[model samples]
Target: MPSGGESMLESDNGTLGWLNFFHKGIGYFAYTMHRISGIVILLYLYLHFFVLSNLLRGGVAFNDLITSFTYGPYDIFIVMDILLSLVIFYHGANGVRLMLNEAGYGLKHHKLMFFILESGAMILMLLFLYYAWQVLLSGGGV
Candidate 1:
């Protein structure tokens, strides 16, 4: 059998090393998702502001830009929007859980709190998506 140092070196080597870092537990999973969602939301905020800036040009320019999102290859944008909404919801819910833990609340029930927060986020995301889908399919044009 390999020595401890040799085993550590082996696990540090390639794809397995990366995969080994995630999903070890609820805390680990939540930490990873929180970081990822935070980054995604930050990037979306930048893009959102940039797009909104187009409105400064004129009503016609703004209308044309918005109109471009309604059909064709831009249909993928709808899926992305839904994903962004879910990420935002997850990030917000997880942030609250983390805040409570830091504040000396729910420390003993950390795992349970993680589960409850994640479930609540999912339920909220589903409800939002249901309404979003209705708006999308009703020819509401986002």
Candidate 2:
């Protein structure tokens, strides 16, 4: 018989755990997005804490940290903001779906409802991007 560690490794040898989970169905897609978005939000929380901690040094230090993202050459900040917004939407929407199912509502049409939720999420994302672009054009940042 295989050792415990060997068996565990063997079980996953042909497939990546969560990536394989993606192929299952809409339910799995919702599950994976929820997990991934939760992780991203958690990491962003850690980053927010670190950024705020800079304020402990002085207002100047904090402003400097903030400037690095808001000023030139770091479109990454806007990109991350967009992505974070999208993740937050997906996570919250999926949570609502879970809550609905738990309450014995929409269990049969959960997939259709998920698509509807995702469409709304996409609209919100586009609205965010439009405003961010306007801000950029207004010389709010370089």
Q: Per-candidate TM vs. native? A: 0.77, 0.76
Instruction: Encode model 2's per-residue lDDT on 1-142: one tens digit a residue.
Output: 1111112123342444544544467766676567678999999999999888888999887776676776645658977887788898888777777776667777768788778877887788788789877876786644
**Cα lDDT of model 1 overall?**
0.71
Q: Pick the candidate with the highest TM-score.
A: 1
The residue-level lDDT of candidate 2 at 66 comes to 73
Q: Which stretches of candidate 2 lie over 4 Å from their true place?
A: 1-19, 139-142
lDDT tens digits, residues 81-117, model 1?
Answer: 8889989999988888877776777777777887798
